[model samples]
Target: MGQTSKKRGVGLEHWLVPQWPAPNTVFAYVTTRIGGVSKAPYDSFNLGLHVDDDADAVQHNRAQLSQCLPIDASPQWLTQVHGNCVIDALDDGVVREGDAAYIDKPGLAAAVMTADCLPVFFASKSGARVAVAHAGWRGLLDGVLENTLKRFPDAPQEICVWLGPAIGQCHFEVGGEVRDAFLQASTSKQGVAQAFRPSDTEGKFFADLYQLATLRLKAYGVCSIHGGGYCTYCDEERFYSFRRESRTGRFASVIGLLS
Candidate 1:
């Protein structure tokens, strides 16, 4: 995986650009908690409307995001339910119910909102297709990534993936049942088992989401993985973390082919 670099946009200065070798026609960005207007807790630049932030503020922030994008089209957001639902990208102003969205043509960007859950970005090496997925523990185990990959016409090896900010293994503690569930669902039981380690609590383990996602992608033959050293819980100033603050807002991870 390559290191991600930060770029300064007009209104959003701290947004991240995936450092992977995506084609010039493909554009991807991960917004941080910086920029925009909202009160504390949600603060500024909170893109999630479902987090109880003022709807107008979120819309304003969203408009700001759209204004800053290189493309003219707005991102198509989903009514994410932490399930494995994947859909084609649509920006008709209707919020679709899906955890992942993809598009083969340009114009519309696929986006997912998250505070602590993983956001995975996908782009074909040829820049003809792109997608983004919201993968929490439930969604990941339910095969959201696989479903998103299946929507692409390219083989897994030709797709490039980038894992966005999320709660890292250092703070993502889960019970033994969660660990067992992952192992039971995986073919590489031993390899997947390594992503979890015993915590101080007897029945709890620290789960490495980055490693788990990488393993899942590799299992599908996707080797061009990048991004993922961000811990939303640890980086309080830059990201919003649900585990850190139960009533926090959500940032967005968006990707699309440039129109």
Candidate 2:
């Protein structure tokens, strides 16, 4: 991983991308495979505890991350079962087993872990709240983004979303069953069918996860969206890609308010 200048009490590490515009209310970031003490495969910055990394090392890495944040609230980690379950951040200190988390209270961090699955961050245009979703293919197919949007209780146009890094379309090959599930949800066969490219071999097709996400967001009337152009599986040096390194560590995408 690369190193960038550290300032504003937020370390600008090369692996992390901070959002533009309302940078104060929607503080979002993704941790790369750097700046930690986990061993190989987990390599340095592994933030997940269930991935077989030493428990002590995971704790140390998480502590280091806490030091970089602007608030004292601990990150509300998700069990991430790859379903559409979304938790309210008001239920702090409780481990929520879900694919997404939303926080209306300032200073409480909403977080999700992933290696190649998409990490979607959400915020209201008024900057009153923010959310983070761990959208793997299953979660996306099951409506994680839609569930996250439902929490807002505001018009879809009042929200802004940022799709974080994940395995890119070029590298995400899928079978017929995976394609069928998405197709079933399609409003128009022409539009959804375009999201998949037929593979040269067998019944496999290359699916664009970002494109799928965008379609879902569009359905809910969200327009101010960004990010979702990086492939963790391809960028080995900067990300801990699970598909690339089968038995590897997980990275985190986090969002919170500044206290």
Candidate 3:
């Protein structure tokens, strides 16, 4: 576990927390908009490589994040496509085009990048493995969380989850189609239908992403969960919000095992 603080020079502030009883199993934390070397839009401390930021600057920022982690455990980066596909990080083949990554192997890290999209982290209570998922509305509708839960060998009750910052309900306005998609997927779950409420603007509705995620997790029997209070679109200074800035940079959420 680590601690959160604002460091000068870098221009980025980071949040750190420990996974207590499971001390040996390193969990997840996110990077804020403050530190890094990218200019304008990207500002500082942007870790996204594919976002049109100067490659060299992105590389430098990534290096800074690496320095913060233990020397033995290198962070594993992924090519996210907002799909439910989950791959094993231990495989050294070409980067898989998917939304999630997991690993039971010690010293291997699993990470996902996001702006307003949810970054959900998972760890077995027994400390056997960990995973991270990028859950945008598309991915969520496609069953990303359910797919990731299936990756764990243990029962869903043994899995612990942490839902990272994302667009909150008040700021997450969606069309009727989006709400219908969730209602369709949550067929057996009766209360899911109410997660969407009509927005003040016509033809739009306020979608509670956090509530949807909780419903999905509970459906799968994963009840030990935490986090999911912040809203990226609402807090521009702390996080990068694609909805707020179409050309903005992305932040990262990382988790791995301690060697």
Task: Write the residue-wise lDDT of candidate 1 on 1-259 in tens digits.
Answer: 0222222346656888888978887888899888879898898889998888899999999988887776666889899999999889877878899999989887678789999899999999988989899999989999999999999889998999999999999999999999999999999999878999999999999999999999999999999999999899999988999999899889999887766
Candidate 3 per-residue C-alpha lDDT over 217-245 given as tens digits, one digit per residue, 9 for 90 to 100: 98889988888878999988778999999
Pairs with backbone N, CA or C atoms under 3 Å apart (clashes), candidate 2 = none
Model 2: per-residue lDDT, tens digit, 1-259? 0122222333336457646444456678888887788998798889898999999999888777766765776788778898999897742577679999988877678779999899999888878878899998889989999999999977999888888899998889999889899989778667678889999879999888999999999988999888878999899987888778788998899888665
TM-scores for the candidates: 0.95, 0.93, 0.90
Rank by lDDT, highest first.
1, 2, 3
Off by over 4 Å in 2: 1-12, 90-92
Error of 1 at 132 (Å): 0.3
As for lDDT, the candidate ahead, 2 or 3, is 2
Instruction: Give me the displacement of residue 219 in model 2, in angstroms.
Output: 0.9
Between candidates 1 and 2, the one scoring higher on TM-score is 1
Q: What is the number of backbone collisions in each predicted candidate, taken in the order shown?
A: 0, 0, 8
- Per-candidate alpha-carbon RMSD to the true structure: 4.0, 4.1, 3.7
> Which wins on lDDT, candidate 1 or candidate 3?
1
